[model samples]
Each structure stands twice: as C-alpha cells, then as structure tokens.
Target: MSLPPDIADLLAPKYGLDPSICTGPGLVAATRLRMEINGLDDEFSYYDQLRQSGEELDAFVEELLIPESWFFRDRVPFDFLKSWVTESWLPTAKPEVDVLRVLSLPCAAGQEPYSIAITLLEAGLRPEQFSILSGDLSPRFVEQAREGTYRSIAFRGEDYVEREKYFEDIGEGLIRVRSFVRNLVSFKSMNLVCAEDYADDGPFQLIFCRNVLIYFNDDARRMAFEGLERSLTDDGVLFAGHADAIFRINDDFGRYGPPGAFCYSRRAKSETEDVPDALPKPQSKPLPAIEKRRRFFQTSKVAELPKSKDPVRLPSADSLTEAKRLADSGQLEDAERICRERIDTGPASADACFLLGEILLARKEVADADAQFRRTVYLDKSHRDALFRLALLAEQRGDSREAGNWRRRAANRAQPSTSMTNSPST
Candidate 1:
C-alpha cells in the first residue's frame, strides 16, 4: 500500500513526477511491468537494470506520463491567442519586431501548438510574423508532434472549416497539418523542471501551458513556474488551465488581461503576495486525471485494442472490422454511426460499445468516452482494456484509491485475456 517508498523517491528527481501526480500504484504497477518485461524478478534487479539502461528509464517514464492533447483543447486559449495577437500584440508592436514568439509546454502530438498556428493564420498573422516553440516531457509525444498528423478527436470544436482550410485529409481518421502551419512550429523534447533543458533563447510573448502545472508537486510546480517566468518577457502572458488559478497558488504572477482568460503576467516586486494558510501544497492536490492516455496513432505494436467481453446478436464480423477501419482511417462519424446501430439492435453488444467508446475518445469527447468504456465493462466484466483505460483515467484525476482498485482489476483480467494482448490500452 505504501508503494515502495524507495521507487517513489527515485522517480521524483529523475522525471520530476510527484507520487501524487503519477499516483503511487500506477508507478509501482508500471515499474513491475517494466521489470517483468526485462526479465528481472526482484525490485532490486529492476533497480539495477534501470541504472544500467537509459532506455529502461525512458520506458518507465513513458508509462507514467499521459500525453493526452487535442487541437484547440478547451477552445478558449486559442481564442485568447487570437485576441492577444490581433489586439494587443499587433497593435502596440513595431512593424520591425521579430517573430511574435510563443511556447506550448507539454504539446501532446502537436495539437495545441498547431492550433495556435491555425489561430494566428486565421487572424492574418503571416507565417513569418510568429514562431511557436513546443516542448513535452515525452520523447514519443515530441516525435509525434513533429509528424503533424492527427485525428477527429484532435478537433475539439465540431466545425471542420479550419480543418478544411488548414489540414489535408490523409485517409482513414488521420488529418495532416498543412505545410504553412507545420512550418511555424519548432518541436523539442524537454522536461519542465530541468532548467538546464530549457531553451536559452526564450522570452516568449505568450505561453500556453494549460493542465500541466496541476500535475506537478509544489516543488516541481515552483520549478516549472520559475522556468516559465524566466522564459517569458515581463509582459509575457501565461495561459493556464482554469482549474489551477495562478493567483491562488503563487503570488509571484498577477492576473493579466480578461478575468476568465486563465492568463497571468509576472508581478512586479511590489505586487508579490503570500498564499493563504489553508491552501495545501500543490503536490498534495494534484489535479484529477481527466487527461488523455498517450495514444500512438495506430502504428505501435499495441495499437489494436481489446475486443468486448461477450456479445449477443452482435453486428456482422465484417461490419465490426469495417468500423475499426473507419475509426482508424479517420471517418469517425461513420464509425460512430455503425457502432451505435449495432448497439441499438443488440443491447448486449459489448464490442459495439467498446468500438463506440474508442471513437468518442478519438473525437476528444472524454466524458462520453468514459461512459462508453464503463458501459463496455458493465456488459462484459472481464473487459481488460476498458478496465485499464478507466484505471488510467482514474489515476490521472488524483483518485489514487480508485486508480489502484481499477489497476488491480485490470491486472487480474489480463492473465485470461491473452488473445487481446495487442489491443489498445496506451
């Protein structure tokens, strides 16, 4: 239950993760899996392997880090960028100014940074007028972002006008960002807490780091905030998630611009204030894990997720296969319709619900996706992939006990579900 304190302490310094952020059991479970995969039986052996193998450590960090991201995720921040650039940035700036620099931390699969490009372009900012520096802790995520490929799930708002204007459909469910947008970003793999890893060439006018601070412990939070502060110009604005109010957490930054912008500007020396006595350390209050799992766009060995438990009067096998293809190919709506029709006709179609759940998730409708995954589980108690997804979601959201409970159930379910091993989880 205590989750091997040694491992907990070991990870914080290396990866800058709080036990509360990864949640104790996910780290332990992942570590155990890492050990077993590497042929190490004991924790000591695994620890030794970790010291000898940088790859192993990378693999471990990959498991614990959730790289969920979407284009225009939450929508408001992109709108804020558009407003700031057109109104404040463009108006008061000199025509001879360098590219209006911006940063997107934890830019999962390039969505946020790409979205920023789209917003600026839509607002008539020429490609040469702005530059986006995108970074993420996960090398896998950084690589994916550089690829510039995405799916319907990455498109948060239903409107496809932007997609049509800025992206080229690459078949199935994949969308590739156009060259103009892709050219605007410079992607790098960097950790937030490692000040050394930060680009010395910063002072970005705006930084979009939504939902990242809430994942850090207080020390790590301070480190990350300090890094951001150092990276920004005095007038630079930080666009954070609404849930983690900067003023409430740290007084070094003051509210900037609109009240609901979730934006902050560095405070002058005289403006510094103290935190309330009642507010707990951020490490103790890590945000709930509504974050998406690191989904590798269908190329990995683990891409094909599990099949449903048991089904009655299910859709034709061909139809289900077609549905998978549709979802994978990027025809999410068609895939959803087919899955729903199957479920409506066959109420106990766990496979249909499972398929639908994956589609919803791909569309970035997380709460709906969560519901569908739960439905798949209810219909088929032994649905390991669904259980694991739920478990990961629970863990990320700060419900450590629930996360552990679901994880245990998932582990138990795994032994018997060998046939679905290559099916989706991460």
Candidate 2:
C-alpha cells in the first residue's frame, strides 16, 4: 500500500519531505512495512501514532529518506572548499577572529562535514582555527554522525588515503574518525523547513548544502533557503548541488564562478533581489492545494515573482536551432514558446519535447520539465539526453530504483560513433 494522502500531507510541514515522493512504490512498501513492524492496526492508527510519538515519526522519516553518501561524495565541492579557503578566506582573515565557522546542513550522517574539516586541515588550518556544525532531520543520523564510525563503503577511490590518516581501523571493515577531526564538528538534529530553529546559529563563512534542496517542494525550499540566506555572512559563499538551482528564483545570490562550480555568493546589498515566476497571481481562482498549505506555515508573506521580459519577435529560422539559441541566451520563455508552438502545430517530435524540457528546467519548473522529458522518452525510447535527465530527476526526488533504471537505459543507448567515451559518474 502507498503512503496515505493524510500522512503525505503531514510530511512537508512536519518533516519537510516532498509529497511527490509518495507517488513512488518504494515509499509505499516502506511505509507498509514500518506499519507492520510497529504492530499498527491500520494507516489511520499509524498516522495517529506518528503525530503523537516523536520517536515513531523520526524512525518513519529515517526509513523513508535513507541517505546514500560517502566521504568526498563529489570531489569538486571539497576541492573548491580548499581553494576558497586558501585563495579567498585566508587573505581576509581578521586578527581578532581566529575561528572560521562552517556549516553542513543536512550533513547526511557525517561524511560531508567531516570532509569539510579534513579539507580545512589540508589547507593548513589547525582544528582550533575552524569549527563545523552539522545537522540532519533524523535523530538516528545525528547520533550516528556523533559516533563518527563508518564501514569501508564510505571511502571512495583515493578517499581511503585520507581515511588512513584520520580514521582508526576498528576491524570488521569499520573505521572511526580520530578525536582531532571529531572535535572540530558538532552534530545535531534539525529540520530545515523550520527556519526559526537555527535563527541564532547564523553568519557561517561557508555553507555546504549540496544535493539537499532538490528534495523539498517549492514552499519548503523557500523556507529552507530563507534560513540559509539569513545564516550566511555577507561575503560568504554557499556551495550547493547543480540540481538545486531553485534558489535562483530569489536573486539574493549570484553565481560565484563557472556553472560547474555550483557555488554562489551573496549579491551586494545595493542590488535589488527579485522573486520571479514562483508566486501566485491575484485570487481570481483558488491557489494550488500545496500553495494553500504552504501559506499556512509561513510566518510572513513573500513578494510576488517578477514577470519575465516581453519576447522580442525574431526572423524565422530553423525552429529547433532557434529555440536552442534562445535558451542558451537565457531567453527561457521565448525558447519555451517556440518548443510549445512546434508541439502544438506539428506531429509530435521527441527533439522538440526534449528541448522544451530543458527550457522548463532553466525556468526551475521541475515537475513540468519532468513531464516533458517523460514525453520525450515515450516518443523516442532511445533519446539518451531525456533518459539521463529522467535519471537525475528521479535521483533528486529520492527514487534510487527509477534513477538506476533510467541511467542503465541511457547507457545502453549511448552511440558508439559519439566522441564521448564513457558517461561521467555522479
């Protein structure tokens, strides 16, 4: 059986889980299994117990949101961390301020924050020169993070080299992080959707929130980013997952470097921050159910998103190529319009659908983009780009099985004639 609608509705406000994850069969089976293990009579009983019992709720969230991560899970972020500290942070270090504060929100057991600690040390900073705060929604995860023990699977590639220096072999393929590394970090349980919980923990110089926001629905994302924005210092850099570009809607930050950097710095205060496309219109109609529920949890009203610039008509060209050009130029609405027109006027084209999907993603309309990509694959099963996109979207939403299936399909369809040899591993 699937997660019940009432239980799913409780998730976003209570635990910050995206309701869309409920549509997958994995969560359904997991919830049913949990209920049986708990000896609950029915879904309603499970819901009642969850609401009344904090332990049960935490356990349920843990079971549903099982994390998959490792030391230096993505090497780019850690490499950038070391570079940023060496090039950017050290030059401006204040004589009176000896300690650099960093945070890894939803630190996912302990790897990410520990990775940050190790990177800072590698950058020649002593443990006393920096402090790290890590948090996750799961109490179990927080406790495990505090324990600082991991199986060999937590080390990937050359990561074991660092592990050897910092971790003691505890036998049975387990390793424990040394006291020096563990001393630099403090771990706790937190729900990012509750912005007020960490309101005073602010002004972190560097925040690593990678691969996190993609799991939240729109309102939850806004709430979480609000907290992140408030917590970061004016000159601080925020490193996030490439897929977590939803924060761009607020304009409080600007891309710090190249697109692949996945890093952002707060825009200067003199610049106006605009919210665009994510807000609802005047109440001529009822708001979406998710929007209505979202509004109920907000402590203040959010500004309406700014309207897009008017599309300038251009000379007709090859429709697909023109759309690509427009999208590349950041004229997303115009690109989207061309793609839609092609779909509406001509026979269904997988290329058009795929391009439309890309346009929607650029606009941060994730659900719509997912639908378009699904349509593209339906039209042409061998469309590798669409398959790859579906895999990423599935993984972002915590559907590992679907992600693996889509990735395998994408690999099978890779063309031998293409110059690219092997696909990059995530």
lDDT per residue (tens digit) for residues 213-274 in model 1:
65566688788876776676545678887434465465555544332355666443342232
Model 2 spans > 4 angstroms off:
40-54, 268-426
Candidates' TM-scores?
0.61, 0.65
Please report how far candidate 1 places residue 324 from its true position, in Å. 41
User: Alpha carbon lDDT of residue 46, candidate 2?
Assistant: 81
What lDDT does each candidate get?
A: 0.66, 0.69
Model 2 weakest lDDT span, ten residues long: 275-284
Give the root-mean-square deviation of each candidate in angstroms.
16.8, 12.6
User: Candidate 2, clashing residue pairs?
Assistant: 275-305
lDDT against true structure, model 2: 0.69
lDDT of 2 by residue, 1-426 (tens): 346676677776776666656656557666787899998767778878877877887688788877778998757667767776777566656535546778788877898898889889998787677888889887789999988999888887875245578889989888998888898898887777775655456557678888677668778888888777767654567888744663344654555432244666644333444312111111222223333333543444433333324322322448877777777777777777777656643445788778888877767778778877876776688888888888899888887878888899989985621111222111
Q: Judged by TM-score, which candidate is best?
A: 2
